[model samples]
Target: MREFDYERAADAAHAVATVHADPDAVFLGAGTNLVDHLKLGITAPGRLVDVSRLPFDEVTERPDGTVRVGAAVRNADLAAHPLIRARYPMLSAALLAGASPQLRNLATTGGNLLQRTRCVYFQDPTVPCNKREPGSGCSAIGGFDREHAVLGASPECIATHPSDMAVAMAALGATVRVLGADGEREIPVVDLHRLPGTAPERDTVLHHGDLITAVDLPALGWATRSTYRKVRDRASYAFALVSVAAALDLDDGVVRDARIAFGGVAHKPWRAFAAEDALRGAAATEENFGAAADAELAAARPQRQNAFKIPLARAVLVATLRDLAGQEAR
Candidate 1:
């Protein structure tokens, strides 16, 4: 690991200003992801502004039925929170579905959203990775890309974002509260992450000084019927090959409303807008669910080894929707 100076932040304003003033400074939460990058020589920041102990660690509920999760809240705590487990079960399920118990205990909400890709090329500094160093070239483009992206990829990079929590948040239409150098702003979770276009180095839309303070989940009464399903090589402690976060609202035998997002298929959480569009006002059936998946995945561009992801993603989406709709029918 590289030598660096560390300072515990006094407050949110101080943390934002400190990191914003220095281009080489970065905020430290629980050091779950950042510390790994530091040891791997992927990132070597001159200063670390410790924000783990800051006041941004509470999970507050508003009268408007919105739940705000602090950035510093541990993943385990967030997942186990009574309100979260009760109201936003999909979010809780997604959180528990990620990483190991030890990691979940130490990982923070902000750190999870800011996590880099798990692609081997991006982690190994010895090889070429456009995400690690722009203009270098993407090693995963033609290399072993079994776990690469099938949607929202560019010639420069095909790496997918690895955040199960973000996928659920996208389906829930959560908003991220950020404190930046300019001021404060709220960005929708779906909009926070962008496609890996020419600039594969940029994972999120957040500016250099922007600090995520909390994530707000708006009240969607039907969210209680939501669920998250993930498929990987193994059962646990594995990144998803294909995953779905879905919430369905059924009116009699027809779909009244729906929210769907896919993971492990795109640069960011793949929001299934087309699928949702196809489901609304349509019959809640397996055939319709398959058609909805087909509508959304029609634009999928799969690579050689990972062409299977397209069908896998389709199956996962259909199954997830069927399961949610079945629950609603009951």
Candidate 2:
């Protein structure tokens, strides 16, 4: 809708250099969310550096049994990959549970992680949003906050980070390989997103001119047995009210290890570290699951309309943990 220049990146170096040179430039991968943002006036990049055809679309498995997904790999292709479907069913499930098939066919791995929030105020230009325009003040604090955050929220803003893949990736302990103007660096998936403390505008730790090259997931034994459960008002094409991605390793009905990450509840993926600590070495029983869910939700500080999210998160976690434990939900 707006006038903009575009070019296909010749290589990674040229792309990074171009971005560094022009602060008004943005790398274009899938263009699903970025294009929409552009049309909505949420973002206006003077130049679009297309990197979708940069020869980084492969998904490879390493000798150590870990998997490395190219940044430009399509969500549909990645989800349908035989190795990913068989090894990381939870990821596939969460991917399929997201936007429609057509969108998934165009969405890329890096773009999905960089996707913006779905907060209504942030999308509308008339509404004052700190994320969209810093120092403009956040209108969601006292207005239409039913879908706002409950945990990891600040007085400045109460928006939630919307990414189903990021939640599953967090549980998998995935690492992102970034190639920036400063060279290469790996960022843990958990540390990728930032909390909305005083600065709610910065959603991630990514620096300017940094291009995410790939995502590396460590070899996890629970990948096959993992489950991702998302609850929403409507089943199809709906964002999660509270979603849970969980994987476990138990010995003789006793929990040996647990990985839990929550979506649609916080600024970043809620890992439930305290809950995992409580579940470790504990019996895989209904009582233990309840205790773990409670421990995780104990820190929840909900607003008027969003107070239900705490119970919703708890119920989802309990049922999801039971599903992972091969127990019937109550």
Candidate 3:
């Protein structure tokens, strides 16, 4: 809605330079989320650096078996890539379980990672949303908050980060490669996103001019036996009420290692590090799985209306681990 200058980036360097030169400039990948925010009046950038045609659209497998996913790669292509489907099935499943086919075809990997929360108040300009205007206050805290966050929530904000791909990547221990005016850097997926502490306005740790070029997924051999389970209000085209991305490495009915992350329950992708720690060397049984889930969710602080998310998250975690354990048995 706001008048802005648009520039097509020649390359990654050009894009980063353009954004760095202009304080009110943002990179344009697929424009799936950015455009919506523009129309909603949530963001009004002075310039839009088009990075859709940048040389970052390939999905390649590295020599060490790790996967390198370009930020400009389409979500559908990433989901259907052979390496992703065969080796990192959890990542593929998470992508497909996200938006519909048309949106997925248009959404880019980087854009998906940078997607904002779907909190109703945050979208409405009239409401008080700390994410939109820090210090104004968070209406979701006491309003209709069934979809708000239950973990890592602050009084300033209770909004959840709505990205299924990031959740799976967190479970896979992926690292995001970024380029900026200074140089290039690799930020762990877990560290890329930030909690809604005092500064709920800042969603990620990225600098103003940082450009995410690619996402490097470490070799997750056990992820082949992984699963992404999402429980939403509807069957399709809906955000997760509680989702689980889990991978279990089992050895003779005992857990050798585990990677677990939860969505729709936290400010960012909630990595179940405690749960994985508890599962290691433990018997692959329902009781043990439940215990691990409990251990990870022990610090969950649910709100008045969204307290159901706690039990829902626990159930999803237990079910996902059980399903993966079953696959290992087969």
Candidate 4:
């Protein structure tokens, strides 16, 4: 709606340098999220740096039994990859469970992870949103909050990160690789995003001029046995009220390992470290799963309209674990 300058990023350094040089510049991947924000008037970047043409839209197999997904890799391509479908079914399932076919075809991997919240007030420019503008106040706190976060919410904002792919990546322990003016470095996907705290405006820890190149997933033995379950209102094209991405390693009917992350319930992907710890040496049982889910969600702070999310998240976790019972967990 507003007039803005556009620049096509020529190279990796240029992409990083461009944004760093211009504080008002944004690196565009697929224009799915950025364009939506621009149309909504939520974001008014002075310059749109088109990074979609950068050489980061690739999915390469690494020698260390890992898969490297370039930031610009389209969601559809990542979901349909033979390696992703076979070895990382959870990631593939999570990817396919999001948006629509047409949107997925244009949404890039990094863009998906960096997508903004879907909170009603945040999207509505007429309302106050601390995330959209500092000190504007959060309308969701006292307004329609049925779809807001229950866990890890802040006084400034209760919006949840809308990304199924990110939840799966957090569970899979994927490493986010970035290249900045300072050079290249890696951050765990889970750590890349932080609690809203007081800085509700800052969604991620990525510094200015830092470009997320790819996400590298190291081989975790139980990856293939993983699955993602999403509970939403109408099923298709709906955001998750609560979603679970889980992978388990069991030895002789006893739990050997587990990784669990939650979506649509927190400021970012909610990694159920408490649940994983509780399930580590416990026998795979309904009661054990229930207890683990409870432990992880025990600290959840709920508002008036969305307390149901805690139980819904617990039920999804219990069911996902049940489906894996007695199977040769990959």
TM-score of each: 0.98, 0.98, 0.98, 0.97
Ranking by TM-score: 2, 3, 1, 4
The whole-model C-alpha lDDT of candidate 3 against the native structure comes to 0.92
lDDT per residue as tens, model 1, 1-330: 578899999989999999999999999999988888998999999999999998878899999989999998999999999989998889999999999999999998999999889999999999999999999999998899999999999999999989999999999999999999899999999999989889999999999878999999989998998999999999899999999999999889799999999999999998999999999999999889989999999999998899999999988888888788773322
List the global CA lDDT of all models: 0.92, 0.90, 0.92, 0.91
RMSD per model, one decimal: 1.7, 0.9, 1.6, 2.1
Model 1, position 300: C-alpha lDDT score: 93
- Higher-lDDT candidate of 1 and 2: 1
Q: List model 3 lDDT by residue over 99-162, tens digit each.
A: 8999999999998999999999999999899999999999997799999888899999999999
> Given candidate 2, what's the lDDT at residue 8?
94
TM-score between model 2 and native: 0.98
Q: Which residue window of length 10 is worst by lDDT in model 3? A: 321-330
Q: How does residue 201 of candidate 3 score in lDDT? A: 95
Residue 267, candidate 2: C-alpha displacement in angstroms = 1.1
lDDT of 4 by residue, 1-330 (tens): 678898898898988998999999889888887888888888898898889988888888898888999998999999999989888889999999999999999999889988889898888999888998889899998778889999999999999999999999999999999999999999999998878899988999999878889999978867888999999999789999999999989888788999999999999999999999999999998889999999999999988899999899998899999787652223
